[model samples]
Target chain A: MVEPLVELKGVSKSFGSKKILDNVDLKIYPGDALGVIGPSGTGKSTILRIIAGLLKPDAGEVYIQGQKRQGTIEEGEPSLGVGMVFQQSALFDSLTVDENIGFALYRYSKLPPKKIRELVERKLEIVGLPGTGDLYPAELSGGMRKKVSLARAIITDPNNPDNAPCMILYDEPTAGLDPIASTRIENLIHDLLFKQGLCRAYAIVTHQASTIRLTTERIIFIYQGKIQWDGKREEAYVSTHPLLKQFFSGSIEGPIP
Target chain B: MNRILSSSGLWSWIQRSWAAILLSGKAIFFLITRKLDFSSSLEQMMAVGPASLLIALVTASVIGMIFTIQVAREFLQLGAGSAVGGILAIALARELCPVMMAVVVAGRVGSAFAAEIGTMKVTEQIDALYMLNTDPIEYLVIPRLVACCIMVPALSILALFTGLTGGLIVAQMYGIADTVYLDSIYNFLDVWDILSGPIKGVVFGALIAIIGCSWGLTTRGGAKGVGQSTTAAVVTSLLAIFVSDLFLSWLMFQGLGQGATMIGQ
Candidate 1:
């Protein structure tokens, strides 16, 4: 059996009095397009943050490429790079799109300015935002900022292949976009996976149905701080799990509370 | 209820103060290791130094003129007109210039640091920096610290000179000769007295930078959090300046009877 790129064994996390993730065991293998769906205020995004090494679990362990992570990313990074696209696009308002995209490279890599600019331009083109490099985050629309952040997430230094993210964790990539914009982002996610092959796997936390159906192959339904159901995308639609049924139906009454 | 609220508030202040101290320690470690970002430091220096020069100079000058005006009349009435410039110089160097410059910067640049970083924190841009493998301390806090440490002293020194010049002009206006004013300053102001302003400035600058950055990094909620952090940072910085000034003054000028002896002479 192929080894999973990332695994969480009995992981748990809490904020203040509220437990966000409760003994959550999860795994993501190469080539996986996973969707994490849940009611609002559940720990859907928390899972992604844990996987990305941005947040530490209150209990249990996280394994990246089968090696147990000893501490948060600040202490030591995983063997594989994990890129995250934040829900709000989180671009540095002070930086231009090119500066934002080329931030990691400019800070970490020995690549010259011209080479970095070329790479940033290429990533911009890949994300369908060519010639928008000079614009700041404030100048870009919400969708455009999301695309810029995507470009930033995928822009890697050719000189440092180890720094390239093997897994991408997206937090509500289509949360506030219009339908057309959401579709565009969903299609771009597919193109990145299938065409560009920028990352080996990705997990998206989203509430949009179109995003779940169009971009994910595997699905997990989280409620009450635990994964209530895990199955293939087709199984998610027909599963008899009451939590999934209630969630998909958008009912006021459910086991979620 | 009031006791509980006040205790919680005190605890929060202690927590913030501790965080700022840790941040300052880390910044000092980074500085000693020579892991400085020169570009960002230069940018911050421009913001903290030259951009604030006009206001600092203006405030210092007015303060000097007012002091001379107040002292010249009293001293001349007592046949001690020659001592007016000396007293003004001592006050400007040992207290006014450093404290006033710090207060101005704590209000202006310190507040900006908190608001900007607080916004970044709430917007997740600080997290984005972490995701990009950039330590926010190294990227954001260190440069600001370095700028304040270097520029605040420089600004205080300039303000001291401006205040002295203003005092000299006012002394001349009060019928005191320029030579007498200059002689009085030379007699009263020693090397340590001249250096005190910059020394106090360095301490106040570190306080302002560390407090502002700490408030920002700990900011929660959203826009409201940013505003609160900004306000708290400035208030904390000002309080720190005044309290530290008291200790510094005592340490630097304790048991000094030179002024009394000079007056007897």
Candidate 2:
């Protein structure tokens, strides 16, 4: 059997008797664009963090490209080949947009300054924020910052192929964004998967029904840290699962909450 | 039972402080073992060093003048006025310059470090660093550490010179001859006395930087937490400096029977 790019096997996490996640198993194969949809504060983003190796699980294991993730990020082994774009855009406020995009490359890649700048420019162009590399994160609009953040996450280091992320996790990429900006981000996600095809897989944790329905081939519904429903796009809209129905229909009369 | 109960708070403080110290030790170890971002360290030094010079100099100068004013009159009345510069030099070199300069830095640079890093922690910038495969110690703490260690000692030296200049001005006001004061300094002060101040500066600098960075890194909550960390960092750094000064003074100057007395003479 071909191994998945990333896998979570029976993973569980807790904080002081509060079970944030429990017995969660997930897999992302090559070419998979998975959307994780659920209510806010129900460990949706926590799943992304776990997959990105920002947090440890209390039980089971996380695997990156089939290797069992073995050390903490501080230990210098931060789940190789996984990149995450945080909900808040998390750009280095001290750095310029290009500098933030080129940060990991400038640190780890053997690429020279000129080449890194070129790559950064290309990423900026790809994100539809061209020629804005000199601007700082504080100077950019919220959507612009998010786009720059996405550009930062997926900018491939050509000099060092190993530094390239095979998969990316996006946490609430459209949160607090207007419909136009959200659609732009959604289109960018689709283009990133189908056009550029640099990364093999991605997991998006978002509440936007449009983002989930358009950006993902598969959707997993998480409620209270467990996978409440998992299905294809067509199946998701038609599923008789009460929670999924409630979530999709935006109905208050359901098992949720 | 009472003792255990009474000391629990102290024990908890020790545990927390020790963790911060251990993380600082790890930062140092990483600095020694890994490739560091020297550009960031350079920027930090530029921000921390020359920016702090005026205040450090002013404080040291005022302290030197005050010490001279208090000592010169008493010594002159006792017919021991020639010893004023020597006493000032000994006191400033042994304790005053380093301790006071550290206090200034802990209040200024140290508090700034805690607030900045604490803000970063609360806002998930630290987490972003981790996500980007960057160690916070290597990226943040070590740069600040290197800057503090270099700048504090450099500032202490400047403060020492400024202090001596202050003493000279005060001596002139008291109608004491420059020759007599300079001669006293030459006769009573040694290389060890001057060197001790810089050594203390290095230790105090490390303590301030480590405490500030650790407190910031460990900060929870939000803006309120950052505020608390800033205050705690400065307070803890001052406490560490004072307590460590007592031990460091004893270690650096203890059992030096002739040298200690001769410096004062």
Per-candidate TM-score against the hidden true structure: 0.97, 0.94
On the 0 to 100 scale, the lDDT of residue B47 in model 1 is 96
TM-score of chain A by itself in each prediction = 0.96, 0.97
RMSD of 1: 1.6
TM-score leader: 1
The sequence of per-residue lDDT tens digits that candidate 1 reaches over residues A9-82 is: 99999999999999999999999999999889889999988887878899989987777877766554643588
For model 1, the stretches where C-alpha displacement exceeds 4 angstroms are A76-79, B1-8
Candidate 1: residue A191 lDDT (0-100): 81
Q: Give Cα-based local distance difference scores for all models.
A: 0.89, 0.88
DockQ of each: 0.65, 0.66
| Local accuracy of candidate 2 as per-residue lDDT tens digits, B241-261 | 999999999999876434335
Report, in order, each candidate's fnat: 0.62, 0.66
Candidate 1 interface RMSD after superposing interface residues: 1.9
- In candidate 2, the residue pairs with backbone N, CA or C atoms under 3 Å apart (3 or more residues apart, or in different chains) clash, namely none
> Cα deviation of A88 in candidate 2 (Å)?
1.3
**What RMSD, rounded to one decimal, does every model reach?**
1.6, 2.6
